[model samples]
Target chain A: MRRRSVVVVGAGPAGLAAADTALAAGADVTLVDSAERPGGQYHRMLPDAYGARAPEAVQHGYRSFERRVRRVLDHPRCSWWAGAEVWALERRDPGGAAPAAPAPSCPPPKVHVLAPAPGGGPRRRHVLEPDALVLATGAHDRVLPFPGWDLPGVCTAGAAQALAKGERVVVGDRVVVAGTGPFLLPVAVSLLEAGSTVVEVVEAGARARVARGWLGRPWELGAQAGKAGELLALTGVLARHRVPYRFGRAVVAARGDGRVEEVVTAAVRADWSVVPGTERAAAVDVVCVGHGFTPRLELPVAAGCALRPGPRGTSEVYVDVDDDQATSSPGVYACGEITGVAGAPAARTEGALAGWLAAGGAPRAGAVRALRRRRDQGRAFARRLAHAHPVGAAWPGWLRPDTVVCRCEETDYATVCAAAQDPTATEARAAKLATRAGLGPCQGRVCGPTIAELRHRHGTGQPPAGPTDPGSHHRPLAQPIRLGELARPPAPPAPDRPDLAHLPPEESGS
Target chain B: MSPRLVPARDDSVRRTDHPLTVTVDGEPVPGIAGQTLAGVLLAAGRTAWRTAGSGAPRGVFCGIGVCFDCLVTVNGERDVRACTRRAHDGDAVTTQSRRSGDPGDARAGERP
Candidate 1:
């Protein structure tokens, strides 16, 4: 029997699990990721050459991740392709050449990758045709815009953590970590461990509101105990380090000359509007701010998958998957944040299911039932977390008209507000056309959420967020690829090509 | 700033056995061999990469490269995202001009 071929788009926990499980299930597997190494964002491994950082900074089941990564890399049926940026997914039109060595009779979907170069120049694109693809492309920092958010020294909490983990450098002399959710705690601790002067941690949610969400369901309280202990422990560390933890507050604005010098924060009402007299200033060289996370929908949307409401009822779109972790599109399965912003555990469980199913492993009713139960538990916990730290709708009250909403396009509050208020610009796409808010190089990664909220919070704003809708990103090429390479004439098709074993090693970062 | 936060001498996390110098805007900047170009920039005190038309400086917003706010010039290549590219010894880098990737400069931040 011919073996099935599979490509997992991310190498993080979910992607790695998917690839590993598929390989174990007898399907040949290839793991492709933009990063130079496997371990998507959760287990993001630094380049091998960088040896100065501390592994303890990312102390989330490191031994397990190491073992999992090893399992994928060491498996005879599994291959790892790092530094591969998937640009687009092309459906296998009938009779067209498929990208991998699989059942040759039926062409599978082809994935286009723009391989990264060490010094950055013209690079070759590698094409992969797999019988199944699991997209575990993880989430990025969700930043709610403030007056000086576009300033030089203001960065996301994820960036601060990445620097310490990947480069052994903390981003600030005196950093003020601001945002909602438990994610901020580790970020602050990572900075402190890395020797940064963490002046404070400011949470947007009030203590009472956060605790309500933390308590969640009664049975889940046992599940929440570990996280609660972690959060409590982080607070103790902050006290020892003399870092103040402030609740019911948010960084309304960051001010600086060339780089950030100060963060002005204020207490907020339940709706998140600022309290009148609570404004205060903190002197800091860097401000690490984030609302939470938004699911990365580019890959799934590009693949023409069905979209569902994101975790916590946010307008963010995510790929909809079924019981076996299969996406609406056949042969495509989505795990991890791509399905929704559940943490590593949920993503891993989903990944195992996806890998097994994508490998054509027949579902045994008993095992399937057990796995489904576990998957549900993980998701329920995530929902609680998302609800606890909802991106306050009133957050925009902090923004003045001149504030920049889209950093890539330099679109400001005034311009976006104008577009939102305009009758012709009722939709996000129309507003984008009118003001270029979400049309920058990022294709709206930094500003899309804020733009969507602005179009609504302003009341006059229109164009409800929808899947494959104008308000949301629907671009076929999710990641950017050089025009010169893509525009170059397609190589003549090789006939009867199902052999990929002889491909050269990927172009590694030197 | 506290001896410029070099990668620790030894840690469980990966690092290079030796350090290398990458050039930033014609000036030699010392960095560990395996650090990212953005890491090199942050380690060297060159935090922000470009000044906007509004004169607001922008650096590593979404450090994982999705934001495109960290674009810079590598060697002669214009408008490359520093967050995504790794730094090699003697790699030439420069702060991208605010106007570089706008409609004006033909050499702008192009995705690869």
Candidate 2:
């Protein structure tokens, strides 16, 4: 029998684990990632050109991660497509020129890829139709809007860390790292390692609330000993560096002439509403703010996967998946942060399970059971995380009327408020059209969740489409493709993969 | 903000000293081979390369490819993400802006 072909989009921990297990299960796998290296942002690898003697210095669990990378990438059945971006996924209609007899319950979507050509040449597009697809597209930093956030020297904490870890470059001489969650500790450490003087680390969640969230389930914390130890080490480094960690505080505004010269931090209540007369300004060259993470949902949503509200009361949404990590759309599986904001361990377990099942591994396998239990623990951790570091419903109160809400369009808070108040702009789409908030080049990746929550809280515009609707995340084109590239025909499939030849002639570009 | 490269001794991770240069806005900015355009620009004490529609200066907001805030024109290709695009020697990069009269301006650059 021909091997079950699996195409895993995203070479992060989840995607890499998926590819590794699928190949181990005797399936042909194609692993693709937009980055030049296999590690997604989690293990963001320094460029091979860097030729670092001690590459593990900036990374965690490097030895294990390196072993996994070699196991998957060196496997003969696995094809690694580095620096390749999946521009779109076209759902294959069952009736349209598909193979007859034993039709797949869920035919995998046709993957449209703009494969990077060697030596910086123009990219050549290739189309693939795999038997199964796994999306581990992961997430990005979701920064809530604030006054002067549009300033040049302000950036998300992830951005600061990426530069520090990937490029060994500091964002500025003096920096303030402010956000919610334990992720802030690592970001601060990365900046410090890269030679930045971190003046302070501000967390929005009050210490009492965060303690309650974590301490409520004491026994469950044992499962996350590794994560806790990591955080403890990070805090130790911060202490050594003499960086102040402040709780119940957030950067409410940034101010500067041309770039950020100072950040205004304010104490906040449990719900993140700023306390009056608690504002304090600190002189700093850069301010890094990240409320939490927003999942990269374009691919999953495009694949027609159903979404559910993340955690409980938060406005975040995640791909809905079953015990086997199978999404609503058959032949499609989702893992990693796209499913929920569980860290790398959970993502890896979920990916392993999804990969095994997608490769036609038996459901009752011993390994499958272990993966399920671990994934469940990860979900519990995710719930505790959400409870501890919830994005305050009152964060919108931090926004001034003139604050730029959409960085791309320069749509301000006042404009969005007016649009919500206008009866003519009833639906979310209408408000978007009127205010031009999420219609910019980013297509609302950065500001979609913020806008949705804002409208929902205002209680004036059209109610959210559904309980799980994360408005404005849906975009036909997942990544930017030049018109010239779109107009051109795709290159013929590579001869090594017989599966591509099975695609209909029209789709194979034969 | 003076963004500088971490000295090799101080940096936790050691890096190869491969040198490269990219001309940004008619000025040659020196950088390492593996460094991105944004890395080079930030190291050169330059921020706010692009401008918003209101002519507000902008640079490196997300430092990832998602935000598109670090966009710059590379070798006549428009809207290349400076944060993600590796800086190559001799690459001519012109900062982009949404302000009127900028080269990216549709009406200003359109050919009849």
Best prediction by lDDT: 2
lDDT by residue for model 2 over A72-138, one digit each (tens)?
A: 9989888888888998988775543323332348687889988776565778678888999999999
Among all windows of ten consecutive residues in candidate 1 chain A, which has the lowest summed lDDT? A489-498
Which residue pairs clash in candidate 2? none
- The whole-model C-alpha lDDT of candidate 2 against the native structure comes to 0.86
DockQ score for model 2: 0.78
Q: List candidate 1 stretches off by more than 4 Å.
A: A52-58, A93-108, A116-121, A221-229, A311-313, A365-367, A459-470, A488-498, A501-510, B2-7, B10-17, B100-112
* lDDT (Cα, 0-100) at A23 in candidate 1: 85
Kindly provide the TM-score obtained by chain B of candidate 2 when compared with the true chain B: 0.88
**Over 4 Å off in model 2, which ranges?**
A94-104, A459-461, A495-510, B106-112
